[model samples]
Target: MTNHKVDTPSKIEWTELYNQLLDKVDVGIHVIDEHGKTILYNQKMMEIESMESDDVLDKDLLEVFKFHNNQHSTLVQSLQTGKTTKSKKQTYFNNKGQEITTVNDTFPLLQGDRIVGAVEIAKDVTQLEKVIKENVLRKQNTKFTFNRIIGQSEMFKSVIEEAKRATRTSSSVMIIGETGTGKELFAQSIHNGSSRSTKPFLTQNCAAIPDSLMEGLLFGTKKGAFTGAVDRPGLFEQADGGTLLLDEINSLDPALQTKLLRVIQEKSIRRVGDTKDKQVDVRIIATINEDPLDAIAANRLRKDLYYRLSVVSLLIPPLRDRKEDLSLLANSFIDKYNAMFQMNVKGLSEDAMQMLYQHDWPGNVRELEHTIEGTMNLLIEEELITAQSLPTKFRRRYQNSQSSIPEIDYPSLSQDEEIKPLRDKMTEVERMYIQQTLEANDHNISQTAKILGISRQSLQYRLKKYHL
Candidate 1:
């Protein structure tokens, strides 16, 4: 057996290592003595509070940071109660007079049951809360209705019929579709058709929200619960008797998924830091852009929550799957853009329609809508849209698809054919070659010239000579 000798680190070295580790962490850390004097404040805490160690070290916590009262401090609360506080939101102004909000987990340090100090771990959510308020919390009185949804395909019609049936009942709905497939459109239409059409309609995209903010954002917050918390109604409360659309619900944290399931079962919500539950008559309409079974198998979504929210599950087919409606949808977009762009464009040409029908529409309806909007922006005097007026990238896709066909369509030779001049024959061949190269490369002058081993000026001269 081999014995390994280990050199123990000195007390000073150990202390330095601990300080370095604390400074390197992303979360803000602060420790104060039982008497409420700052003892340890890490680099992140300084960044969060916008102060230096010199400004906070050994200073009284009350003097260093402005609080409504001593009870507002999580560190002080933990110190006084001799207990740990987890995920408590605290808001206060620093000496810089900036209102800082943080979600803190504070623990009291004990030396054999004798209170020494309390250490706090905080995550800054001041800016996040502001963004949520400005963007996510605002109510949108949706104007979309079933009449506005346009699609004549049997599959699409059946899906719309199913959605219409859903509106008749108040059961929770789960809309599943690819991104930009008008999941939100269907959601809004369903809400407008429902009995709660006069009520508020709210939405929140759950994919990017941090876990700490999700709870309070969904459920209301109680005043005095945190340093700066006020009595605020959450999405459920704000959308009472209406619909609260939680888009991308599968992206939510599993713990929150459990909470959501509870809310669905109980039909009530308890505000953050509140002891009492409030009954809310809000209807939830959740949407996910993935296969629910796949999400559940990957553990991204909880099966139990899926079962609860999917009482009226809807699978909206992607645009590619319903290509039969391409012409109808294109004409609708043409009409819409005509009014918006003040253009009198009548319709799409046959060639342009063929190109549109060839597209797989990976972005679904939104992509098609934008394509029409974009194509119309380039139209000037043309009354009808031609393939030439389509976006360059779109035209390139159509051209590339045609690349597999024979490059030249030779004119049929007659038995008594009249011979043309050699120069004319060469010019005809050169024009056809240049035209093919131009179409293949999205008609980009520089790219076509480069592919043909000619300068841009040379290509421009040839294009004019051939009237290409």
Candidate 2:
């Protein structure tokens, strides 16, 4: 028998090793007790925060550090929920009053069922945020004229012509399209070609912000409006001489929609909690994912507001609607990433092009762009992206769609439904598609679910419902 002797360190050595290890890491590490008192912030954290070791350790974090104290704060959320909070972007001021952004992951330090403390691992992304802001500024500055739209389809051409004519006059333009059909791109192009091309161009997605903040964002807030509020310029004021694109415009609250209509008609805005109004010259361009008439019918948008905003309407066709442009758009995206990633990827292979056309493209142009960029990022050696080089979701969808042709008829779950109603025939087709998808992947539920874009539980329900 052979005996192995382990060289275990003493308690003091173990503690020293832990501190040295944490201090050597790149990311900032902060720890606090369950009561939100600081306990074990590392040296990296002190350096990032511009503080010394003794300045933070064993103090109540809220009292010592300048956190917003809102739900967006990392420590507050993790301590309240008693769960790991991760990848939440927090914009907070440093000791020098410089607003720094960080992507943080915080986990509760647990001992059995009793909660002891929590630890936060943070990465400073302030520079990355600066780059993103700069890119946005560049887009606002660049001229995305009609020539930059990258499509030659007749339907697409007609829309571009209408947009060009609309740019001749500053009638409020409303662009309607499915999500990811380049509504914002169209908005920017219209702004660039307009008489106000030299002025500032800004955008606000109505659906992304809360109603409480939406009002203040559209119309600037006064110093006395709320706690910590300052007299700042709003989107209307900022884009005074140029254009302000309100994306997902229908998502604004009904009351706010009425206010928006007033601003469009009055060409002025009153800051929140202010008694006076400020006049401004700004072109309002709104975009909706669904039809404006449908939104009005559903009462999601004000009827009067709709009429006021839709003076000049443009509809960007979906990728599936302009299937011919798929190849062109694919090439355009390839060119974009080749410059951005410095890759020599020539273009998609013939089979890959066919696969792109076969897709339904529920996510439209944005999804296609992501698919192409994602594939190019992973692609090595081969200059031409083939069907095999496609993302897992795209490849699976293409394969399942190809297998659905009647020429390769597999066993149908509803065999007797062929002579029945159209709905039953559609169900039979659905069943066959799902069954074949399952079989092709050797009955792996998770992969099949991903291919179909459904939860595993949803797939299981369908499998049982269809008896596949």
Candidate 3:
């Protein structure tokens, strides 16, 4: 028979190893006696409470340390129960007067089935809680991505690539796209991906604020600079060492544009009433719906500022130009609204999808999203959205176009055609013609309006009025 033996370490060596293991553990451990006096505590526990082991040992638990109502009650309940209470209780104040939140489990120490003391195990959970909160906020705030940009066409791919490339640089990027093309999204992506990601990313709509308030809003005002003037830092200062997006920058007043130019050029700003110049390290990302060159020529944008901002200009293609991405975007919005409204509406029907593809989205992605949301709100059943489920204007637009071909006019056709007044007939013809033109132009309203010898705004008004 073969003999096998296992060797064990000495008692002293084992004790040292156990102590070393407990010392390296991340959780805090402490023990209190039946008299409410601390008998043992680990280094982690002392560090967590910001107290030394020597100072805490033999100290009355309630007298030496104050706990919040929740923590105190939890500990007392555990002691009374003579059993462990595992919970996520928070102790508010630390030694430094800062709030410290922790998750703790308190267990009663048993000596022959009699509670002699209690041991508490805790972990610092402040950072973990903060991370969880931030994640929830991020999920709630932004969910759309390139897929949500809508458009499967090659034009969209080119624009996305340009946007991706612009995100890699600190150079001022100017996104030139018609209103509602999701320019803000591209700007957000750039800021989120840049080296200044951890810093503040601010957005100011140049058109949203009036000229009178523009200076104060962008460069900030000093105390008593104006009525009810409290000292407040402007967006430029607030976004210091970060990125500031100026949306619809062309809408700024000419003088404000000049001041903005200097801020962008010199990398500094002088507050409204302050003489001292404060240095700012801010990256400017401006968006404009108009052509920068045209804006400069019209004195709407300063030439120098326009040139500086256009150092890396990106043009976001209109949704109509990227028809291929329509299905992807439509489905994305369907899923989003489905979850948001808690509705069971699944998706668009093939005919509804065809109608979507055929329609010219003058308002771009924003318009599409709104349309989908509106449809979902009006949906009556769980079935797919059909042409009949579409808005009245869309139905009229589609029906008028379908009937305008002037085919063989039978009684049924005659009833469908019902010769109305000349003005009404002309209006119907005009509407159908416009729809056909927009469809032919792939929903490019600018080109369609030009071809129809009408203003783009006029076309937009008609589309909205007809719910097209």
Most lDDT-accurate candidate: 1
Better candidate by TM-score, 2 or 3? 2
- Those runs of model 3 whose alpha carbons end farther than 4 Å from true positions after fitting are 1-151, 403-468
Candidate achieving the largest TM-score:
1
RMSD of each: 14.3, 17.2, 22.0
- Can you write out model 2's per-residue Cα lDDT over 1-468, one digit (the tens) per residue? 999999999999999999999999877888888888887888867766777877778887766667664635587567767888656667776555667666677878888977788888876656535633653585457667778888987668877888989888888998888889888888988899989998888887788776866787789877646533456577788788888888898899999998999999999999998999999999999999976766888999898888888898777777776788998999999999999998889898888888898887879999999999899989877899998999887787786676566675656657664366866776788899999999999999879988987545446546765878
TM values, all candidates: 0.64, 0.61, 0.57
User: For model 3, how does the per-residue alpha-carbon lDDT over 327-390 read when each residue is reduced to its tens digit?
Assistant: 8888888899999988887778876877787788989888988989999899877568788887
Ranking by TM-score: 1, 2, 3
What local distance difference test score does each model get? Answer: 0.85, 0.80, 0.75
Best of the two (1, 3) by lDDT: 1
Superposed by TM-score, candidate 1 places the C-alpha of residue 188 at a distance from the truth, in angstroms, of: 0.8
lDDT of 1 by residue, 1-468 (tens): 999999999999999999999999878989999799999999989998889999999988878888875447888888888988777778899998998888788999999989999999887778667755654434554879999998987568877989999999899999988898899889999999999998888888897677877888889788766644567778788888889999999899899899888998999999988999999998899999977877898999999999888999777877876788899898999999999888999999988888888888889899999999988998899999998999998787795775576678777879898788976776778889999999999999878988986545446546755788
On a 0 to 1 TM-score scale, where does candidate 3 land against the true structure?
Answer: 0.57
